[model samples]
Target: MTKITYVTTHGERIDTEAENGATVMETAIMNAVPGIVAECGGACTCATCHVYIDDAWRETVGGPSSMEEDMLDFAFDVKDSSRLSCQIKVRDALDGLVVHVPSRQG
Candidate 1:
């Protein structure tokens, strides 16, 4: 299992141990991590799963693809580092990852 720490804009911290095959959004929603609605359930269609991937981990987890990029444009408060958490799959390489939840999700 890999531990992924989720930090909210309000400073709430949620740490979850996730399986390698699960996506970040799956672990987050299942563990009740706030700010990610995941309305499309990892289909990469909804931006409700928007999150800011911590800068230190950006190289390992880069930006979204064209499709996910298009969808992100619709999310609220999209930033240079914004990403749809549902699209970030958990892997052994991503263990001990940390991401931040935005103040809003639309």
Candidate 2:
């Protein structure tokens, strides 16, 4: 399992464990982590699961793909570190990943 941390807009922090192969959004939804509505599930067709990766984990988490980038256009408060949580698969290498949720979804 991988450990993922979610920092909310209100400065609340939530830590959860994700099964290897699950997506970041899935981990959030399963753990009832707020700020990730996942309206379209993990399809990456929507930006409801958008998150900003912590600077320290940016390179490891990497950037959004073309499709994910297109979808991010519909998200709120997108930044250089913005990413679609649903597009990020959980893996051992992703343990300790930290992401920040926006104040609101699009």
Prediction RMSDs, each to the true structure:
0.8, 0.7
The alpha-carbon deviation from the true structure for residue 28 of candidate 2, after best TM-score superposition, in angstroms, is: 0.3
Any runs in candidate 2 off by more than 4 Å, and if so which? none
Q: Please provide, for model 1 over 1-106, each residue's C-alpha lDDT reduced to its tens digit, 9 standing for 90 to 100.
A: 9999999988988989999989999999999997889998889877899999999999998778999999998899888888999888899989989999999887
lDDT of 2 by residue, 1-106 (tens): 7999999989988999999999999999999888899999888888899899999999998889999999999999899999999999999999999999998887
Q: List per-prediction Cα lDDT, in the order shown.
A: 0.91, 0.93
Best by TM-score: 2
State the local distance difference test value for candidate 2. Answer: 0.93
